[model samples]
Target: MKMNTKGILFVYTMPLVLLHESYGFFVPGYPTKHISVSPQGKLLSTRSIPSTTTKPSLYSPSTSTSSLALKSSASSDDVQSITATNKLDSILSKLTSAFPFFVLGSAILGLMKPSSLQWTNQGTLISWMLASVMCATGLTLEKKDFTNVLAKDFAAVPAGVLCQFLIMPLTAWAIGRTFLLPLPDYGPSLFLGIALVGCSPGGTASNLVSLIAKADVALSVLLTSCSTILAAGVTPLLVKVLVGNAIHVSGWTLCEATARVILLPVLMGMIVNAKLPNLASKVSRFTPFASVVLVSLICGGVVSQNSSMFLSSKALLPLIVGSVMMLHCVGFAMGYFVPKVGLKFSEVTSRTISIETGMQNSALAVVLARSMGASPVASLPGALSATVHSCLGSILAGYWHSKNKKGKEESSESNKKDFTDRPEDDYPELLI
Candidate 1:
């Protein structure tokens, strides 16, 4: 049921994603413009660049046919190569934008045929794949991004992280109890997996989602980076505190695993990005797409291995799905409302916080679940959480995008005398 419900969630979510992607991303209203300069040294918009209209003078000597032919062929080759590159990029963009659909399809396949992804269920394989995703995400960051968050003026960073760690752990526990997840003797409940997931850091995909939502992308990046770094210590402590009586969670073991699997690779990638930006830029383009693929595989592998759990009980699936989805929904609501209404943050920053808080690093949760020696079915919640939050995030982005647009329109109506038509001193605030 967890797998099937996730499939349904993705199926419903794809059209929303596609609708936004048509406007250039899993979002709308943010279009990029390309401009070029002519040989005569005039800047021109690509859409309106005029062709040469000057006629040749009668006295001019004729150029050689062979030289002219070679030049023409060379130019034609360059144009063809450029065209092919653009097409590849467009296709890749579409694939990444429609990522939830692909993950859903993979989940369906793995659930139907468990043996196909059975080989990928090993502990080492999960660890390596998760590490690679973390590394890929880190490659897109630089020293300045982390440093900016540490600046004294960035008060929201610490506050947001505090809320994430505090709110999510409690939320997960409450939701589990509400759903009546068994208390140990009933044969290895999902408490361990839910606890670990609740304790997870912000996902790497938060920044992308924030971008699509027109939120504060920089703030989201900082929150993800800070929470991930702190997870090495905080997650282990929280897990020990939450479900220590039922599950023997070794703080040292969990901490070591996190540092090795998550922190070290992230730092390594950051170093490379900082020291060798040229190489990082070229590699970063493909990292987002690769991370999406790795996430699908991890989710599929978990579902495939636990197919028996799904097959055994049709009734328990909804409980698991509802709990996981509710966890993220609570996280999003509290994360946003606390900052926006309670603390009086700007709309963009609040939206960013909400996304970063809600989108848990479920892949990390899946790895930790297996590493902790919980039941095979324990990883089910983490596997399905990814799909649930992605669907919710898309809906939020669309709603917020339309909201910001309407606000701008209303403001425009109010300020009919925009900039140039008004006195310079009277319109200073509207210049931008």
Candidate 2:
């Protein structure tokens, strides 16, 4: 299985590299000379004089008033444009920070009326939505961000990853055995799903959540990728040991899915950003809010599709819910305190580890669960996991964003200088 997975990784990687290079070669997103940067560093377009008219130099005495007037008008226009743009960013920032509410509402809506989100439950749409979210994450990143992770934050990778495999899987097995009442009568298969989720690597969504929370997004992405690569060996071994020989998952196939859903989309987004920085910056302004929406939809759609499975029993509801909820909360708590208190890392780095540890590849869990040869209902735990982890991560992001903003405001008032460097446009911070 390991060898096969390696083969698959090689096949997928070659094509992906070619495609990324092809895109960069064909669409080098070069900025035009007409593009101008305002004093505030905002991009603007300046029109050239007509061929029939000679453009007067600003130094010429004859056009001094005209130049002054033009400068005044242009400055006025720039102010209006910047004001409008900032206002839009402020609105998006509010909305993005409130995404926990949106996600929670979506989950509730999906549970109540599965038919409403039923159309979006298709496999292709789900993949595309997830890809789009990941792409948005990639757009926010630059090559330097990754290099920083490699240089500074590389050591933290194994520490946090250990928490994922060591803590979550064992905790999951214990919880699954304890909480579930065996509703569907396929005990091992349902338990297998639970175990699989715990053993799964850090979610691709972690990268997006890290960005939103103002955590170490570059570290989160690196951790996620590293964990995924390790999952090929660790996942199967953990399942075999914990669950005692369930139907095996194809690690190569898993890698292929991940490459399509995560690696490729992210690389493509990065390529676009590197090639067309101006275009990327313009598009990035809207991506954070868009990602929140798509994540809500994806989670809600998963719940909607699996609504009947877990909801079939009133008794089963709390059992499944309580189990998964407890598992993720433990994951989040342990993930947070371990890095925060034990390792004595910065708050931001610890938070990044917390998110990466908390969010699992539940979609991968769902796919593996389906092959368990148990009833389709066995996949419910993985589906429920998606709702639980995403909601938790979103809430964490929302809370952290608000707290970070409050701190910035206090600091700015004391120092009399707005120091909030709005990094990567995860959300726009307005300097009031």
Clashes (N, CA, C under 3 Å) per candidate: 0, 0
Tens-digit lDDT track of model 2 for 1-107: 02244543453244335434432221112122233444444433333333223211111111111222113234677666655665566456545544445555666
Clashing pairs in 2: none
Candidate 2's TM-score reads 0.67
> Which residue runs does candidate 1 get wrong by more than 4 Å?
1-25, 29-86, 148-153, 183-188, 407-432
Model 1 per-residue lDDT tens digits across residues 1-432: 344556555644664465454533244533222333434333332332121221111110111111121122247776666555545554455556555665665576567767767878864898899999888867877777767766733878987898889999999977765564564332245777777789996787677678678788778888998898899889989988988886678888889888888899889899898898778766766677788888888888898888877778766667778888889999999999999999998888889889988889998888888787777777888888877877777678767877776775566545443422544333211100
List lDDT for all candidates, in order: 0.72, 0.65
TM-score to true structure, per model: 0.80, 0.67
* lDDT of the structure predicted as candidate 2: 0.65
